[model samples]
Target: MTNSSGTITDKTGAPVTIADDPDNHRYTVTVDGVRAGHAAYADRTDDHGVAQRVFYHTEVDEAFGGRGLATILVKEALDDARAQGRKIVGVCPLVAAFLKKHPEYSEATSPVTKQILDWLKR
Candidate 1:
């Protein structure tokens, strides 16, 4: 069963919750009601005018490290992007690695491009 806020139990059995903070352009993950990590992203339009969500970075608190929180955070962020009809661009190494291991998300994944990188610099 899932919690109303979409909480799930992590490997350590702690209640984990992931939510999008659009105002900050990131998805935050919480463990037992405390913030654990976040996957940062930027919304932009691609050359073809397609909406894209570029995941640029992912970080978990030192105290929350090694708990599989980053994986959960990225998965939730990617899923959210897919649901919102935005293509996923994995600029962050962690996110890129996740995409490599998860082929199911390929349909929604976009290759990182020079234009996207330039946009991110600004």
Candidate 2:
């Protein structure tokens, strides 16, 4: 079931919520009101000067492992990006793996480039 705040109860009955915290440059997921994980990203201008969101890391708290929170987090993050008209780039392993299995996002996804990696280093 879903709550008015947009939180949903998963199969385990854990109430989960995902929201973008742009100040932190990440989208965070909370389970039962506790932060479970976040997908970190950076906003960058691509070769064509189009703004894109580069997801470079994702992690869930060890206590929350195996809850599929990462998948939930990434999906919401990607959807939000698309809603905002930002192209997606998955540099993080989890995000890349998710993208591979979810082709519906292909048109909104951008290939990871050396320039993006280099920008991340700084």
Candidate 3:
């Protein structure tokens, strides 16, 4: 998973890379060297604390969706965050929903997610 030049090639020659555009606070994920997924966020610091509000999106290409490409993108996002020691604010409904189903990923959510438990209310 080397991010050299913002690309990671799989063993079968399929490459997936993620890019962080600090100016826009967006990250694009590419598969086999092609754009397959994306995530955007707003980073802010205030009197309470600093937080990164995030959202994720994936192309509807049949070749990508059915293959769990979005999940892979989420995994990559989590892995990247782990490496960078950052907490996330899951503003994307899909990501927020995912965190609800996977408690192990709770740490990946923002500090306030417990209060945002609308998903669990049902």
- Best TM-score among the predictions, by candidate number: 1
lDDT of each residue in 1-122, candidate 2, tens digit only: 45577767655778889999999999999988898889999998777877799999999999988777888899889999989899999999999999999999999999998878889999
lDDT of 3 at 48: 60
Error of 2 at 63 (Å): 0.5
Please give the TM-score that candidate 2 achieves against the real structure: 0.91
lDDT for 109 in candidate 1 is 91
> What tens-digit string does per-residue lDDT give for candidate 3 at 10-43?
4444666667767866677677667765776555
If scored against the real structure, what TM-score would every candidate get?
0.93, 0.91, 0.63
Better of 1 and 3 by lDDT: 1
Query: Which of 2 and 3 is the better model by TM-score?
Result: 2
Lowest summed lDDT across 10 adjacent residues in model 2 is found at: 1-10
Model 1, span 1-122: residue lDDT tens: 24567657677878989999999999999998899889999999887999999999999999988888899899888988999999999999999999999999999999998988999999
